[model samples]
Target: MSRSGGEKERKYESDESRIDSGIDSYKSISRDPYWSLQSSEEKDKSSCGTEERLDSAYASSSLTVDSLGDFIEKCSISEGENATDSENNNEEEVNLLTTVTEDGDTILHLAIIHEEQHFAHQLIELFPRELLDIQNNLYQTPLHLATYLNQHSIVKDLVANGVSLELQDQDGNTPLHVACERGFWDCANEMIHNASPNKLAHVLEAQNWRGLTCLHVATVHKQRRLMRLLMKKGVNLNTQEGTSGKTALHMAVELHDVYMVNLLLNSGTDVDAAMFNGCTALHLAVGRQDAAVANRLCQAGADKMIRNMEDETALDLADGNDDILALFPFDDIQIMGRTVINF
Candidate 1:
């Protein structure tokens, strides 16, 4: 009887252990990530039309997915991806998304972030055609990012494919804008040399979200050499900023760069270019108490009577302070313009 009881107890224990083991296995199969992936694959293969199987895709009727699936669902499909279906008119979209994040970064963006040339090349190879296209997010194409990151080879590769240097972002910024703004001359040259010189020039004058052109950015950053390239690109020698009415010359005068002053003047930039407030470069110089710039502007034929919106002249900004006038001593110089007489 003892032997029988012991045997029965052992059997009961084994049965309980087997049941628990089976339950644990079922739990893993149900909850494991890999199992979920397999189930997804199986489901995908079974459904000839994936339109109905979109899990959480159209949970909200207003939210739309603009991707490969959208292309496939169209009824008027042409002749491209599949021959078996009567409607296969979908064009073979170049797979640009080597790695697209939920937030919309591509592999090219990652290449810039990592500074990985080899990785960039690999990603570029994944879809050579798409390399020329701008991304939906950040308003920067691969070419723009390459310019920003100073990747000359990457820029060369993309520009060779005819990436539109003229393509503007939501801000109206172009590839040249990115380069000139960041002071990346090498990258800017790569784009220009690869195309008709006229193509990027118009883009150079293209403004950004802030209504600032590439020339404006270069001036603000004090990038004198970039100013040279911009002039070569035919950026308006006299393009005035809309809000401030400050031209490249206006900012250059403020920076105390006499060379830039001469360059702008030689390039036909108006020394008397006025800002929104009607303050000319001379006015800006006076405001900064920079006599050198003031004298240079006067020599460059700056009209002394240009007034601000408030009717305050350059001298007025200086408060008719003799110390400020002493910097330029414009009254002493005999030029085409009369000395500003502050009453």
Candidate 2:
């Protein structure tokens, strides 16, 4: 089944043209893949033909792993050849790199997903920065997937190559969110320590759809180590969650976490920072009947007089708890060298 060089060239050109034309047509029609797919599913139910064509183009462009390796080998061979053939090879490389699966996963994505570490490393070297950020159907960039899968080297390489660290997955989680949530220290460190100084703040503080920042996630997950790392990286400790406006201290207090409360206090967290309902950590501690955490907060100078939306102060919420009520004094008080009350 051997063919002449001319015949092989013609076949390559034909396949390339079909793939390229299909990709261009898809781009022209669907600017946002997720939205377009949804519209086709719900309102434009009759557009099945259009959807099929799009799917066909995506599927047609997918190369088997072996095919990809062989094509990449051919591209490497053409690198130092004459100008015309080199130009053709470069065009083919671009087309191949941009080809996505029906799930919108590029070859680079598949390589990482399949844990082809050696091949993934090779492809990372070959891909341009823009190509490194191609998101799959789940809106997971290769960096997100790599972090979620705990691939430290891939995370390092992707960050070193300057991929956007702020690209959120379908769940609105940045790679940092995934790293912090999963307690992956090395992967999280690569992102925090290597990100551009100006941009690192945004990455650290970026919230998910649920309004939980990386620090909030770490606190909720009880990741003190990651929380400390984030704090050292200058994350805003007092940033509130989007839903209830509860800071990390607020969460720690509600969890009856005395150690966490002390950690936040020592870290200079705003002890009286309020939630959306004007409830402070002190209020939550007192209401939850957590005598230990409430005492810890009081020792750390938590304001007992701050009222909640229900017009209840921590003292008002301390219904019949002598241990909690004992921490408060009717006169002005000083704890941890901070004045917590004013007459």
Candidate 3:
């Protein structure tokens, strides 16, 4: 009888352990539906229709326009509540904004993406200004998207609504950086002009993750008009990027973009500005065998005698390249002496 009782007790303990394990597994699957899938076949079917699932989920009346309007109204009403109520209301408001699609795009993001300008405008007016800077899965705010998509009106609305101009995306590119990179002068102008005097300097000077200033971006893209506008705004013309230590003028010369080089030079850019490697614009021009650019640089008073870190002068870099060598007028001193005498 003792042996039989002991065996029965062991059996009961084993059965209870199995029951507990089953319950824990059920709870895990319940919390995450993805874990409930039995095979790769089920996972593929679920993953393939994610967008469609999101669309249907959004269409299920829980995330409709009416719901958004209701949410806005509720938040507005909660603003006048007592401290305790206000705290709870703020939490609720956060939850409303946190509601997102599978891609982590808020309703505002969708409105901007779909060009629902009227709806976007309504949402902008009703939503808290803080929501304007909320980033999507791409870490792009509505303002960033507007600037990138060239949505002028949306950009204006965002600015007018007091969105943070300094908000950076995943790559640390502020909206203004994107504007400068893409040569969106209109958008850039809007942002600059709309900014408070106190903020204007900060906005213009904000660098991207690559340590490129707005002026650096303009130079890299050969944006003559944008460059002029930025210069007019009194941006530091000689600001060198940390990576290459090359000023905009150096970049202009390197690209062999004579037009940009002329613009920079005429604007009083340091003609002989050198990179971190001590390579001057004249050195780069000679290396490219660009006679016209070389001549322009010489006329603008670029020091051809300047040596790079490699200990090579522009003429030395020219080596046997006659086109570049010929641009350096050997009679420069004679011409200067004659002019002075004539004067």
Pick the TM-score winner: 2
For model 3, the superposed segments whose C-alpha errors exceed 4 Å read: 1-98, 329-343
C-alpha RMSD in Å of predicted model 1 compared with the true structure: 17.5
- Score each candidate by Cα lDDT: 0.62, 0.76, 0.70
- Taking every candidate in turn, the Cα RMSD to the unseen true structure, in Å, is 17.5, 10.9, 13.5
lDDT of 3 by residue, 1-343 (tens): 0124654454344434231121123223333544333342343334342322212211111233444557556554422468877677777767765677644567776566545576677778777888878876557788887787688788998999999888787677888888888889888888878888767778777777787888888889888888998888778878888787888888887888989988888888888788899998888888888888899999988886777888777887776787787866564442311322321
lDDT of 3 at 298: 91
Clashes by residue pair, model 2: none
Q: Please list the residue runs of candidate 2 whose C-alpha ends up more than 4 Å from where it truly belongs after superposition.
A: 1-95, 330-343
Tens-digit lDDT string for candidate 1 (83-162):
55533432333333443543244645545533557656655654557544846455667776677668888888777777
Which portions of model 1 miss their true places by more than 4 Å?
A: 1-99, 122-131, 169-172, 323-343
lDDT of 2 by residue, 1-343 (tens): 1345765464444434232223235435434445344432232233322413332232122343445557556554333578777777777767666667755778777666546666677778888888899887768788987887799999999999999999998778999999888899899999999999888988877899999999999999988889999989888999999999999999998788888888888999998999999999988998899999988888878877787788778887778799888888857664432458877
Clashing pairs in 3: none
Of 1 and 2, the candidate ahead on TM-score is 2
Worst-scoring 10-residue span by lDDT in model 2? 51-60
Q: Residue 141 in candidate 2 has what lDDT?
A: 89
The Cα RMSD in angstroms, rounded to one decimal, for candidate 3 relative to the true structure is 13.5
